[model samples]
Target: MSEQAQQTSNSYRSGPDERGHFGIYGGRYVAETLMPLILSVEKAYKDIEDDPSFWSEFYTLARDYIGRPSPLYLAQAMTKHLGGAKIYFKRDELNHTGAHKINNCLGQILLAKRMGKTRIIAETGAGQHGVATATVCALFDMPCTIFMGATDIERQKPNVFRMKLLGADIRAVTSGAGTLKDAMNEALRDWVSHVDDTFYIIGTAAGPHPYPAMVRDFQSVIGNEVREQITEREGRLPDTLIACIGGGSNAIGLFHPFLDDPGVAMIGVEAAGYGLDTGQHAASLSGGKPGVLHGNRTYLLQNEDGQITEAHSISAGLDYPGIGPEHSWLHDSGRVSYAAVTDDEALEAFQLCSKIEGIIPALEPSHALAHVMKIAPDLPADHVLVMNMCGRGDKDIFTVADKLGVTL
Candidate 1:
C-alpha cells in the first residue's frame, strides 16, 4: 500500500485540514493567478462555517424553496422481487429541479450572494447542474453562463432546453471528446479570466481546495436526513448506503454523515460504459491510478504518458475520467467500497425501476440500482439498504429511447 493509503485517522469527518487535503488526495493545485481567488473562497466559507444565520437561511430555502426532508421510501415491490435486503429509496429525485444537484447549487449561490458575486458560471455533464444553477440564478436575478460538452448537449437536449428556458447562456465545449472533463476545463478557463465579478459554482465534489469540501458540506443534507429519517422509521442506522458517482457530489453528500458510523457500509457505483477490460469505462477508482486533474489529486483514467483518456458512459453525468478527491481518499482508506456498473446493467435497472417501482429514475441513479440488484438478493431480508435516487428521468427519455431502439 502507498504510505498515504496506510495512514489511519481517528475521525473520517475531519478532513482537508486547513489546506484542503484529505490525506494526500485533495489540495489546491491551481495556477498562481487563481490562488488568491481560491484562498478568498476558502476564507469566505470558513467565515460562514460556524454562523448559524447562514445555516438558518440555507435550511429555510431548502425546506421552503427546494423541498427538504425528501421521503425515505421503502421499495416494497423491489424488495420482494430481490428477496434479500429490504430496499429503501432516498427520494432526492423528488426535489425541485428534479435532482440532488440543486442541494449544492442552493448552498453555493447563497455563498456567491454573500461574496457579492454578480455573475455565475458552472460546468455540467448531464446538464442537471446547469438547470439547477440557472433556476437559482433566475431566483436571485444573476446572469448565468453554463459550460456543457457538445456531446452532452446533444444527448441531454431536454436539460439544455431547461437551462435555456431558465435564462442561462450555454457554451458548448468541443474539446477532449466533448464530455464532462472538457466542460470543466472550459469552465476553469472562464473562471481564471473572469475572476472579478464571476463565481464559478462547480457542479460536483471535485476541483481544487474548498470546492471538494464545500460541495460535500452542502450536499451532506442527504446523509443527515437519511440518518434522522431512518432512525425514526427503523429505529437504527442502515446496513448499506449506495449512490452513483460522477464527480461524487451526491455520493459524498449521502455518505459523509455516516462516515463515523461503524455499522453503516457505503458503496459508490461508477459508470462502466463497457467492460473495464475494453478500456471504454469511466470507473476511475476501479480502473485508474492516482493523478492530478482539475486541480486536485485523485484517481483518474489516463494513458501511459499521463494524458487523460476519454471516459465513456451512457449516462452523461458519469462520463468523466476522474472522481472526487474525497472519494479517492475513502477508497484508499477502505471506509467505503467502490463498484462499477455498465451501460447495459444501468439501462436494465432503469427499465426495471420504472416498471416495478413506478418511479422513472435518471440514468445516474440507475447505476446504483444496478449494483443493488447484484447484492440485494444475497443478503438477509432484514438487511436495510438505502440507495440515493439522485435524479428523475425526464431529462434522459430521448437518450434511453435511442438506446432501446424506440421512437420518442
Candidate 2:
C-alpha cells in the first residue's frame, strides 16, 4: 500500500457519500423532534472527522483505554483439521466486557458528550451491549438506562446484575416476543417520549440512517487493523472475511472497508434456529423478503400481512427478523454472500472450538464457524480466512448446558 493508495482508501473509507446513506440503503430516519439534534450530530461528526488531532486522541483512547487494534490470532489448530486456508480469529472477544460492543459504546459515549447530551439510553439483547453501554456510562459518569427484553433479563441474569452494578437502570420490556426486537421497540418508544436530552446509543449497525453509518465508522477499526495486520502476517488481504450478523453491525464494520477490494470475499452468517425449512429460523436473508422494519428498508422475516414475525434462533443475539439496511444492499448488490446455520450445527461448532482452540465463542460466532467448517474444507490450502468472534459465552452457559442435558 503506497501513500497515495492509503490516502485514497481513507478518503472513501467512511464515504462514497456522506449524510449517512450507504448506496441508498441508510439515511436519517427520525421523528420531527430529533431532526435538529440528528443534523447537529451529523455536522459535528463531519467536523471531528476532519480534525486530525481528534483522531489522534481517539486513537490513544482506543489503544490505551479501550484496548483495541484487537489481536488477529491464527487458529492454527482449528485450521489444521479443516485442511485448507489458514484461519484467523479477529478476537474482539478479548475486548473489555468480553465482546467488541465496547468499541462503539466508548465512541458513542464520547460523541454524546461532544454533542452535550447528558443522558444515554439504549436497547440490549443478551445484555452484552447493555453491559458495554453501562461500563462506558459509568466511566463517563453519565446517567444510563438500558431497555432489555424481559426474557433476556431472565436468561441473561448475570449480565443484568452486572448492568445494575454499573449503575444503569434496566427497563424490562414484556410485549411482543420479549426479546431483542421487543426491547428495541420499547427503546424507540422511550426515545420518542423523551427525545429532548437523551442520546440513543444503538448497539448495532441496524438503526435508521446516521446511526448505522456512525456506528460502522466507529467500529471500522477492526477492518483498518485487519488490512494492516494481515498484510504483515499473511502478506495480503484475506481471501474471505466472515462475521456473524446480529443487526449486522459487526459484519458491516469489518466488511465495509474491504468492500471495494475485488479479490476479497465477504460472508455474513445468520442464525437458523431449527432450520430454514422448518420455518423456525432467523435466517433473515434466506428466510425473509425485503421489507421495511425498525426504521430501515431491509430484509425482514415477516408474514402475509405487514406484521413482523417471531424470530427464533438458539443464538439469542442473532434471533432477529430484520437485518441492517446496508446488509440488505450488500445482499442485493452481491457484494456479500449470506448463509444460514442451524442451531444444532452452531452448537456443534461452539463445542468444537471450545475443545480444540480452547476458546468459548458466543453462539453468534458459532454460526460463522459452522459456515467455516463447510467452506474451509473446500478452499485452497494457501487461502486465508478471517472471522470476527464477536463475544464470549459466559452469558450463554445455562442455555448450552441444558441443551447438552447437563445440570449445574
Measured by lDDT, the strongest candidate is: 1
lDDT of 1 by residue, 1-408 (tens): 255553346778888787878888889889898999999999899988999999999999999999997999999999999999999999999999999999999999999999999999999999999999999999999999999999999888888999999999999999978888999999999999999999999999999999999999999999999999999999999999999999999999999999989899999999999878899999999999999999999999999999999999999999999999999999998999999999999999999999999999999999999999999999999899999999999888898999999997
Clashing pairs for predicted structure model 1, backbone only: 16-21
- The Cα error of candidate 2 at residue 106, in Å, is 1.0
Q: Which residue pairs does candidate 2 place in steric collision?
A: 27-209
Error of 1 at 96 (Å): 0.4
Please provide TM-scores, in order, for all candidate models, with all chains considered together. 0.98, 0.94
Clashes of each: 1, 1
Taken over the whole model, the C-alpha lDDT of each candidate is 0.94, 0.85
Task: Kindly list the per-residue Cα lDDT of model 2 for residues 291-390, writing each as its tens digit.
Answer: 7766666788998897899899887788788888778767766768998889999999999999999999998899899899989988888989999998
